[model samples]
Target chain A: MFSIASSELIQIFRNRLVLITSLIIPAAVSAFFVRQHETYADLGSLGYIAAIVLFTVAAFGLYATAVTTLASRRQNLFLKRLRSTAEGDAGILAGLLLPVVVLTVVQVTAILTALAVVAGAPANVALLVVAVLATVAMMIGLALATAGLTNSPEHAQVTTLPVTLGVIAMASWVGITGTENLAWLKRLLPGGAATELTMNAWNGGVAVTDSLLLLAPTLGWVVVAVALATRLFRWEPRR
Target chain B: MSTTPVIEVERLNLTYGDFHAVKDLSFEVRPGELYALLGTNGAGKTSTLEVVEGHRRPTSGTVRVFGHSPDDRRAVRPRMGVMLQESGFSPDLTVRESVGLIGRLTRRTDDVDRVLDVVDLTGRAGRKVSQLSGGEKRRLDFATAVYGTPELLFLDEPTTGLDIQSRDAVWATVDRLRENGATIVLTTHYLEEAQQRADRIGLMHQGTLHREGTVSELTHTLPGVIRFALATPVPPLPLHAVVDADGKVVVESFELQKDLHLLLGWAQDHAVELRDLAAGPTRLDDVFRAINS
Candidate 1:
């Protein structure tokens, strides 16, 4: 798993396209919005801004990267080549996702640290951490599901359109607007619960029961997406 | 060399829904010999190979590698290497990285640099796969397959994109590996490569093993021919001879040596010059051609 992850990190992080999509745009967007503190009347706006930044990383960084990387590997016969090796199928998938997962963790840490320095730390820090971990699992699962639909690396950009827009747009909506009439929308969409949890983390610490309630919807998405991925994932290139 | 075969396939049959891809095929690759599996398109060779490689399950029959089923990949794959028609390397990885990845995955303990050296890719080690030319990529494929000097190696069109020099280098390496007691199972379009290298050959047509033997053993099944043009009007030979429209005499004989000696004596007695006299055993291609018929 480490060998596969190390090789994948070098190949993925080296590409200029991935660098811009996965890191630069997300960081830049987060920094720009984060500097606009006067626009927020409450200090809790810090976590909301941080949520937007992390949203881009999950969508483009982990999810899109996973889909394209897996699809490209399959198209080029690398997956088939690996199948002939001593690595099992589950080990291969874990290795493929490990680098992206690590990268997501690092980038999220950076965002949270910045929010800490600016807003003096979120009140419900434990809940915020759980949301980040849950979102990571969700993104990885969704990526595998999208990869099943992707024909090639080139096809990944288009195939990932629905997930990218849904995750990022809902994140942006929850970060910037009121939830008065859109209450159910927060639990219905894929990343909605996590976005709400992150955005509200600075308000106060939540009860353990409430945290689980907030996590259930996203957790459900992870299960369904992973189940679909296992069934749909192709070891060979699409015909 | 050991007497036991390294790979044994017994009455293997593979079917794809309504299509029968292989029919009761069977062959063995003995230890330390280069065995070539030659066939025409859709001849069941690829299907057979996939089953042996554990990529597909045979509809019936059994394939054993080192006395274990190929489906027990963890037990079998570590001891074997396969170079398919395409290696399917990730273009984003450098040559050295790609070699290392395959080596580690194959449980090879050899240093990555040494494997690259074997394929003459040491100079291009730092270059990404995308930067390498077509022939260079083929060499990379060869490098990965031979990473651990695997006990059993499968080469499917190994030299397809290689140049003459590179082809010679690959064959040289294969010779060295065979000398070290590695068993090689090859599938290629180049008949001469098999003719020169294989200790035994399995020829498949449609969905069955049409013939299997050493090159000479297979070639001897057909009659050899002697062709010559007369300087003047052609005379009948001591043996049964046929003349073509171009006025050239042709003799087909199972006993080519004795018949050719008699024909030489006949020409000498008549003082007739035998122009363009050519006599040799039938080639592997001829045996292959007979498959379609």
Candidate 2:
């Protein structure tokens, strides 16, 4: 698995287009949000900015990149090549996605830390960490499921738009509006519970028990995404 | 050197929706043997190979590699090396990196540099796969397949895009591996390769095993040919012969050597020059052509 991940890391840095889309673009977008934190914080809250930045990195950096990587590998038969080895299917996938997952965690951590430094630390750092981990899991799951529907790296652009945009939009709606009007609906959307959890962690005044309950919905998305991935994900492209 | 088969397939059937890509195919590759599976286009050779390699499951059949299921990668794969029909390396990776990655995944240890040297790709080691030419990419693929010198190797059209020298090098490497008692399963369009190297050959057509045998066994089913052109019309030939459109005399003979001697003696007695005299036993290509018929 480490061998595969190391090779993947090498390829990721070598491809200029992938580097830009997966790393630079998300970092730049997150930097802008961090730089303009004050304005966005006034519109929503500091926690809201945190959630937006997290979703930005997750959607583009982790999610979109993984979908494109998998689709590209499948189209080129690299996945098939890997399977020709002694590695199990699960190990192969873990190896291929490990680098992207680790990178997303690092990026999210760095960006969230910067947000905390400028806009005051969150009320519950532990809860915020949980939110980040859960969000990453959800996004990775969705990416696997989306990769099945994607034919090529070029097709990934069209196939990934809905989920990428939907989650970001969900983060925006739940983050900016505070989830009071349609509380149940807000918590039920894919990214809604995670966004609200991030807000409560950073902006306080919510009960710890209430915030912990938010995990159920987020975990539910994980289950749904994983189930969908199992059915949809393909190791090789269509014959 | 055990007689037990190294690979086994029994009544294998593979279907893609409504299309039956492979029918009830059954063949076994014995230990320390080079078994070549040759077929016409759309003959299901690739599909059968994929099932044996555990890339796809047969709709109904049993495929065992070394007494274990082929899908049992942890058991079968560590001892087997597969050279796919296409170049599947990430184009962004250097040839060396590609070899290293695949080599490690095979769970068989060998010097990466040595494998590159085997394929004469040491000079192109640092070059990314994207920068290599078609032939170079093929050599790179060959390099990886021989990385650990596994017990069993699958070479799928291993010489398709290769140049003459590269092709010779690949066969030479296979020769060395065979010397070490490696079992090889090969599929190629070059019938001559199979004829020269295979201990046994399985010919597939329309998703079925059309024929299976050694070179002599397969070729012997078809008659050998003797061809010669006469400068001047002679008396009735000693053997039955047909004059083609170009005035070339053609004789189909099961007894090639006997018929050739009679024709040579006839020509000598008449002092008639037999131009372009060619006589040989039936070739593998003839067997392949006969499949369609």
Best by DockQ: 2
Docking class of 1: medium
Model 2 chain B poorest ten-residue lDDT run: B227-236
Pick out the ten consecutive residues of candidate 1 chain A with the lowest summed lDDT: A37-46
Q: Candidate 1 lDDT (Cα, whole model)?
A: 0.85
Q: What does candidate 2's lDDT look like per residue over B221-290, in tens digits?
A: 9999998887676788888889977779999999998988998898899888989999999999999888
The digit string of per-residue lDDT tens for model 1 on A91-192 reads 888998898789888988887778678767777777778888999999998998999989998999999999999998888677667455687876678888
True contacts kept of each: 0.75, 0.88
Per-candidate DockQ values are 0.71, 0.91
TM-score of each: 0.93, 0.98
Model 1 alpha-carbon drift over 4 Å, by segment: A37-46, A173-185
| Per-model CA lDDT versus the true structure | 0.85, 0.93
Among all windows of ten consecutive residues in candidate 1 chain B, which has the lowest summed lDDT? B229-238
**CAPRI-style class, candidate 2:** high
